[model samples]
Target: MYGQGMDAAPNPWFSWDYVERNWDEVSDRLVIHTTLTLQAVLIALAIAFPLAVLARRIPRLAGPITGVSGVLYTIPSFALFGLLAPFTGIGRTTVLIGLVAYALLVLVRNILVGLQGVDRDVIDAARGVGYSPCECSSPSSLPNALPSIIAGLRIATVSTVALVTVGVVVGYGGLGQLMFRGLQSDYRAQIMTATLLCLALALLLDLVLALAGRWATPWLRGRAS
Candidate 1:
């Protein structure tokens, strides 16, 4: 469609000229997309961390909490957006709600597993050394759990980045909006640019999180070495 011609058709692939012409608009959308993704991840972490701690504290409740989060994760993005549109009105709020809900399952499960994995003897050792409950949990247990927590964070961050693209229908999608417009106008350059940007953003965020994880858990690196 983009290269249709009476005699000879032009190439329908990506065009650097088109990208140069639309660079400003694309850059703006990229910022918005990155901001929205990060916001969703931070909010989800705030909600999930406390619940994860609760699940660790009360072993019996862990299964039910996980089951609930799993159910939330299974809801289709479009369906969730539709459901929230009436209450929140179609915008960033609706998009964020959907993203945060999806992130909770992964974040909460990983945190709970991390905390639970702490050895009982190590916890006792902390207490036996005159460590207060707070110290025992935070300094001792939390550091040990950092690996799992960071793993969950990495997964949630990448997943949210991808999901943000789905928000294009509700008008909150960053690059997704570009992709949708490109499709309607049969612009291969725009489509290719948006898709590549999305991939790049996801990879960039994942790499940053991986580095942060390594920094947070130096002991793991030491053990590996």
Candidate 2:
């Protein structure tokens, strides 16, 4: 139907003119998007590690801690922005806070699971052989758990990249801002560009994390060989 409409001038989805005219805006948005994704993931990782370790250390608190994270993850992004805007005001900070909160559930759970998965006997043996708690955990537990923690990082980063677009609601959604405007104006090119860039960013981050995981866990490769 769209192709048959010869009465209207052709409106293509790929327009060099669009990129040329809005190069600065698009580039700025991409940088903002990357900044938001990176900062959120890093902050979440910092918070998650301590929480995960605490949960592992204290078996009684593990369920409540993870349950709270699950609750945080289930809150809709827009709803989070709405709730935070009144307190933090509409800005990047609000979005960053929400993104970090969303990432916590995945990161904390994965780290906890990985730590739990490490064989108890390994730790016991290390303790029997005169290793301190610090040495046993660092050399024995965390390394074995590195794969799961890395997996969580990859998942959280990709999820955060996608979620950052929802921040357009608070006027700081990075590329999401472009996509929102495009939607309002029915600008297909802008919409496609934003969508594609988001996907590319997520994929790039995931690939990097995957490679990092493989490098961190060389024993898996050695075992297979």
Candidate 3:
């Protein structure tokens, strides 16, 4: 009877049966995980892009601004989330605050580098042609900077997706919750599934962003050709 009971026990390492049984739940969690990641990245981009532009315009402040964001990035995500719990309570808001902080330094530095990389000759020509400040910066400067900016986005996004798993400590960690539950219950299938899903999500997003970047900068293709 003992031998039969042991044989009847589900395999801990891998279980297509578990996945088949829980597909709906897995899908829902995946959607939540993806949404949270995208929200954090977009918010970081919104904050970082303008800051990078301002830093470019005012070179004197650039060092200090990047320094501050770098410090924020250095603070551990768990510590950041814990600190924010008092002010924001334990939830998506706390996770977002931490994720955005981590993303800023990378995004800001890349954007500034991209903008600064733009040719002086290009700017001069744009100005010579009666381009307004907005046109000169946006139409002339931004397109050239797109590749760098997209690179930053890809890095920020993948990093955010990984960090989102950390949020499970606070009950807002999307797929992280599944991982935590699996760990608590000693369910290997749940842990493995969540981990594989996170990896797949990250890879898929990176590919999509890469393609989008290439599409946005058609000249790069032309230049390569």
Candidate lDDT values, in order:
0.88, 0.89, 0.88
What are the per-residue Cα lDDT tens digits for candidate 3 across 1-225? 111355566646678888999999888889989998999999999999888888977899899989999999999888899999999999989998899999999999998889888887887888898886556666245588888899999999999999999998788998998899888777889889999999999999999999999999999999999
Colliding residue pairs in candidate 2:
none
Worst 10 residues of 3 by lDDT: 1-10
Runs in model 1 with CA error above 4 Å? Answer: 7-11, 127-141
Best by lDDT: 2
Give TM-scores for every candidate, taking all chains together and pairing residue i with residue i.
0.92, 0.91, 0.91
Global lDDT of model 1: 0.88
Clashing residue pairs in all predictions, respectively, total 0, 0, 0
